[model samples]
Target: MSEAPIRLLIADDHPIVRDGIRGMFTADPRFEVLGEAGDGAQAVELARALLPDVILMDLRMPRMDGVTAIKELAKLGNTARVLVLTTYDTDSDVLPAIEAGATGYLLKDAPRDELMRAVHAAARGEAVLSPSVATRLLGRVRAPADPLSARELEILRLIAQGTTNREAAARLFISEATVKTHVLHIYTKLGVNDRAAAVAVAYQRGLLTLDNG
Candidate 1:
């Protein structure tokens, strides 16, 4: 007997995006587009109601973002695997979604065949990531073993928030030279030569987080 088509729920803020995804998946016999949601809240609701085998989730939404929705689903014991489809490839976006229990992360620019394969993999509870995201993840995984000291981590966070070395020095009651030294140490430890790359690597490796407060 033929297997059942994979049931799918799409959650994206854009109507046209939803339309395109729905049309693409519905055209395939191996998949079924069960429903569409305009935001994470609606996605969570529909996911509970429909119990789709996979959910194509977008990162940014109205009520809640994809990561929060994924966390909520996990908390509520929802069994559907989440596959993130978004334009964002930054570590800030990819790391949280994956950490929040996303089964896969795919860029919006991915080919139709790749999206189909990602959906299939997600339905099977496998992890999938776009090539760029995979490379970023691999780099983080292979990062140098030098861990940042507590003060260096603090200075890195301040830099991530757009603080200048002088401002960080003032905030920490340290000399500007000390802050610069710490910044350099952070760069070396994170395997990056610049402040932005250091912060990005920090977030990717779970050393930094979005302060909701």
Candidate 2:
């Protein structure tokens, strides 16, 4: 007995790129290329229809872009994990794709083996990134700057303690607007756009301690 091959959709504007990816996946017994689309709109439609397990998406495409496609797919409740395959390694491209719910990012020049590994990882709901992209993400995360003020740190401590912003503001005797400002500052300080990341950073840096009572 054997496990079924992972179904995949390849979405790229270049025929050569799509063909190359198709070849690579076909070579692996664990993967099956179920469909291919040359643009983002068609990709979205095919993904909705086919419901592939993974989507290999290129960032720049005609009619619609990969970021928009990823967002639209998520909005439509598509469960396929999008794995971005692009030539661009810039923060602008990477961040937007991740924010749009892409599960992975890989360079166009990635070796066949790495691409295969990324495909499998993305299929399992894991985030995969090239080493350079990982370095960039870590650099952003570790930059030493107290983007949060003293007041913001206090607010973050409360937040980590599971306090709502309104509750934190009430406890601290501050306005909700002031609490929001502190939260925004905390996000900036941690170089993260969300509360989960901010909390993780605070916990990692010993800025937030847990009471396991």
TM-score of each: 0.80, 0.68
Give the residue spans of candidate 2 off by over 4 A. Answer: 144-213
Q: Of the candidates shown, which would achieve the greatest TM-score relative to the real structure?
A: 1
Cα lDDT computed for each candidate against the true fold: 0.91, 0.87
Tens-place lDDT digits, model 1, residues 38-86:
9999999999999999999999999888999999999999999999999
For residue 67, model 2's alpha carbon misses the true position, in angstroms, by 0.4
- At residue 84, candidate 1 shows an lDDT of 98
Q: Pairing residues by index, what is the TM-score of model 2? A: 0.68
Give the lDDT of residue 115 in candidate 2: 87
